[model samples]
Target: MSSVKETVDVAAPLRIAYNQWTQFEEFPLFMEGVDEVRQLDDRHNHWTTSIGGVRREFDTEIVDQLPDDRITWRSVAGDTRQRGSVRFERIDETHTRVELTMDVEPTGIAEKGADALGVIDRRVKGDLSRFKDYLESRGHESGGWRGRIRPADPGSPL
Candidate 1:
């Protein structure tokens, strides 16, 4: 598994930034290589992406979610095996720090090679940067889902 983490400070307020992040379908506008994202439900989404000429379709289940704070998900079924989280931190009334962390398992030789070469890391960083630009320019979120999904185990809290 290869882990990649990246952060970007957006000029938008924390609520605006966090709300924009919840609009999964709009990810393609800022996330490079992402072709489409369909929200199946409050806790599930279907994703289509082409990265490094490899196309993949995956379904992710949101294991935990908290409004205006963080979202965490893991691949439930599909061609991808990964888990990740995005955190929103309020830097100020009009600024937010967005952090993303992902752990992906390379399936084949090509993917392993790319991971070793830091391709995945660079892609994540670039994606976050684009997200910042997209949100800052828009000044508001397209849509938002403020629903909450607690962690799977009752004993654990997020």
Candidate 2:
């Protein structure tokens, strides 16, 4: 398995950032390889994504969630067996730091080699950078189910 974390500062407050992160449906706008994500139930989500040239689908279960701090999840039974979390840290009222950590197992020798070469890490970083841009953009969150997600907690959501 490989793990990585990338951080970026957002011009929004901790609450806004946290709120934005919980809206799974909006993930397709910034999440790497994600084609669609929908909350199936309170604790379950259905997702369709393309990764490594393969289109895959999965049902992810939210393991733990803490408002304004962190949210963690893992794939149920699918084309991928991966788990990860995105953490939020407040740098003040207007600057929130976001950190993402993912643990994944490559499927083959070539895939493993690519992962070891940091391709996955770079891809994740690019995704996060896009997320930051999406959040700070002019219009309200694009195509997000604003009322569907529940916040993490009052403190760290890691």
Candidate 3:
């Protein structure tokens, strides 16, 4: 598995930054290589992505989530094998630090080679940078889901 971690400081307030991130369907606007994201439910999302001419469709389930703090997810059923988390930290009233960490298993030789070359790491960093710009320019979130999903208790919404 190849692990990638990246961080970016956004100009928006913590709440604004966190809220905008919950708008999963809007990810294509800022996330490169992501063609579409459909929120199946509060804890599930379907994603379509084309990276390096490789197209993939995946379904991810949110394993844990806390409003304004963090969101963690794993691929439940898909062509991709990965898990990741995005955490939000308040730097100040008008700024938020977003950290993303992901672990991806390369399926084939091409993917493994790209991972070794730091292609995925660079893409993740670029995505975060674009996210910063997207939120800063908008000045407000498109939408937000404040619901919680705890890994220990799937049926309970905390």
Candidate 4:
């Protein structure tokens, strides 16, 4: 498994940053190689992405989530094997630090090569940079999901 962590300070409140992260459907706007994201439900999401010329599709389940704090998920069913979490920390009233930590198991030559070459890291960095710009420019989240999801009841949203 290859691990990558990236962080960026956005000029937005903690809620604004956290809310925008919850908007999974809008990920393609800032995430590179992500073609589409569909919120299957409050705790499930379907994703289509092409990375390093390899096209892949996956379904991820939100294992744990706390509004304005963090969200963690893992690929439950798909050709992809990955898990990650995003956390938000308030630096001040107008600044929030967004952090992303991901663990990915690359399958096939293309994916492995990209990971070994740090392509994934660069991509993640670029994604975070874009996210910072996107949220700062908007100055607000497009929408938010304040409900929490606990590991004990993964599908039952709270």
**TM-score of each predicted structure versus truth:** 0.96, 0.84, 0.95, 0.95
Best by lDDT: 3
* Residue-by-residue lDDT tens digits, candidate 2, 19-132: 888888888988888999988887789999887777878888887777778888888877777899989899997879999999987777667888989989998999889988
Candidates 2 and 4, the one with greater TM-score: 4
Error of 2 at 78 (Å): 0.6
Q: In model 1, which regions exceed 4 Å deviation?
A: 154-158
Clashing pairs in 1: none
- Identify the superior model by lDDT, candidate 1 or candidate 3: 3
Error of 3 at 10 (Å): 0.5
For model 4, residues 123-145, the per-residue Cα lDDT tens digits are 98999999999999997899999
RMSD of 4: 2.8
**Which ten-residue region of model 1 has the weakest summed lDDT?**
149-158
**Which tens-of-lDDT digit does each residue in 1-158 have in candidate 3?**
89999999999899899999999999999999999999999999999999888999999999999999999999989899999999999999999999999999988788899999999999999999999999998889998889998886656752
Better of 1 and 3 by TM-score: 1
Count of clashing residue pairs in every prediction: 0, 9, 0, 0
Angstrom error of the Cα, residue 28, model 4: value is: 0.5
lDDT per residue as tens, model 1, 1-158: 88999999999899899999999999999999999999998999999999889999999999989999999999999999999999999999999999999999988788999999999999999999999999988889998889899887777652
